[model samples]
Target: MNENSHTMSERPHLRVVHGNPTDEEVAALVAVITTLNTRDTPAPPPPRSAWSDRRTLHRPPLPHGPNAWHTSTFPH
Candidate 1:
């Protein structure tokens, strides 16, 4: 394997396709672009907690007949 091949493959993540720009200018441009991209994209919704699960709220009503207290301790 060529020793310089690894260095060659480590190209800049962002490259200007057109127009010459100074190092600081390129950095500023990248920062602005990244900020705008992040701003435009909405963040993913937060994960739902078990306490807020809708399915858990739709449980069968607890029985009121004999052994109601015992049954309530376990799933129907």
Candidate 2:
């Protein structure tokens, strides 16, 4: 027997332990369960918005010295 084999093979064997289920019903149940188990992780949260970000709200100390007020408004 192959070392990787479990039960009779590598695959898990499904059994109807409670009820006599038809093959198609068992297949549908498997499909639903597989889908639930393997669902894609939720898309990562959307990237943070720049305007609303806390870093954008940060302010540098007010400018100082001669003509500071005027130079402050103009790009350095």
Candidate 3:
């Protein structure tokens, strides 16, 4: 055997096996899948916030001119 060659015993052995489900098993599987598919329902809408009322959502107007900063009490 060459230096780079590997013996049959040293090589990895792999095998794949395929299966066929019986008719009854396939029908049961389909029934389960269909049940799962039909169980999904649309979620309910979220509740409205407390600030949803326009009357209670008031905010003071912002100051705008050069002297506006002097009129305002809040620090920049």
Candidate 4:
């Protein structure tokens, strides 16, 4: 008959295997995330009497080329 029917008749259908993880897998993942979040410990605070200096943060300037000024690159 049709080519699609002929191909289907020649090939064997395969069954897909799918299943959910056990409770142990879920608990192990949760324990890993919890350990990661609490791994870093904060240091003690500096002396209250000592005076700290404040400084301004600056970023480097970008290149001024033709492509840098393109209109399509940015949202309208």
Candidate 5:
């Protein structure tokens, strides 16, 4: 009457279908199967933005017809 009652008396239909687990319900089902087979501690990657090392401004193309809106080769 050990080894889980000899595997529930050699699987009497798995012992009347699921009916025998009380060692504190097999220690709370082995603590929920060891917390669902552990493995969850990865979250630390987000902090690098000096405006993404700024560098991208080649503006120069807006002058074509009718005093191009009182143009002034922008660069005040």
Candidate 6:
């Protein structure tokens, strides 16, 4: 054998063997994934018919200004 061949064999080698995952391991992984997928609860809906009476009680004459005749292009 050559001197170079001896040096090549001195390097370390690793061998890894993996087996099938267990059912409990799969269940735990699924639980973690499910937990991550879950989101916070949405805010509750606003009260229905709120300020309905106040809207009807409003009675005021709108002031007609010089710019009032010009239609407002701004969106609501």
Per-residue alpha-carbon lDDT of candidate 4 for residues 4-74, written as tens digits (9 for 90 to 100)? 55364586343225667667876786788788878876767876642432322434345466777674356
Per-residue lDDT for 1-76 in model 2, tens only? Answer: 7765676455666756797989899999999988987776566788977878887677766789999988789753
Looking at model 4, report the run of 10 residues with the lowest lDDT sum: 50-59
Per model, state how many residue pairs clash: 0, 0, 0, 0, 0, 0
Question: Deviation in angstroms for 52 in model 2?
Answer: 2.0
Ranking, lDDT, top scorer first: 1, 2, 3, 5, 6, 4
TM-score attained by model 2: 0.41
| Model 3 lDDT tens row, 1-76 | 7775678777634222467777787678779878887788666889878878785666667688998877677743
Arrange candidates by TM-score, descending: 1, 2, 6, 3, 4, 5
Error of 1 at 36 (Å): 0.8
Clashing pairs in 4: none
Better of 2 and 6 by lDDT: 2
User: What digit string (tens of lDDT, one per residue) describes model 5 on residues 24-64?
Assistant: 87777678877776747566899978667555354567787
Model 1 local distance difference test score? 0.84
Taking the tens digit of each residue's C-alpha lDDT, what string does model 1 give over 1-76?
Answer: 6554445568667867999999999889899999998899788999999998888878788878999898888876
Candidate 4 residue 18 C-alpha distance from true site, Å: 9.6
The pairs that clash in candidate 3 are none
Worst 10 residues of 2 by lDDT: 4-13
The lDDT for every candidate, in the order shown, is: 0.84, 0.78, 0.70, 0.59, 0.64, 0.60
Look at candidate 2 and give me any clashing residue pairs.
Answer: none
In model 3, the runs with Cα more than 4 Å from the true position are 1-17, 42-76
Write one digit per residue (lDDT tens) for candidate 6, span 1-76.
6654535558434222476777887678678867776755566887868567586686554546687545444322
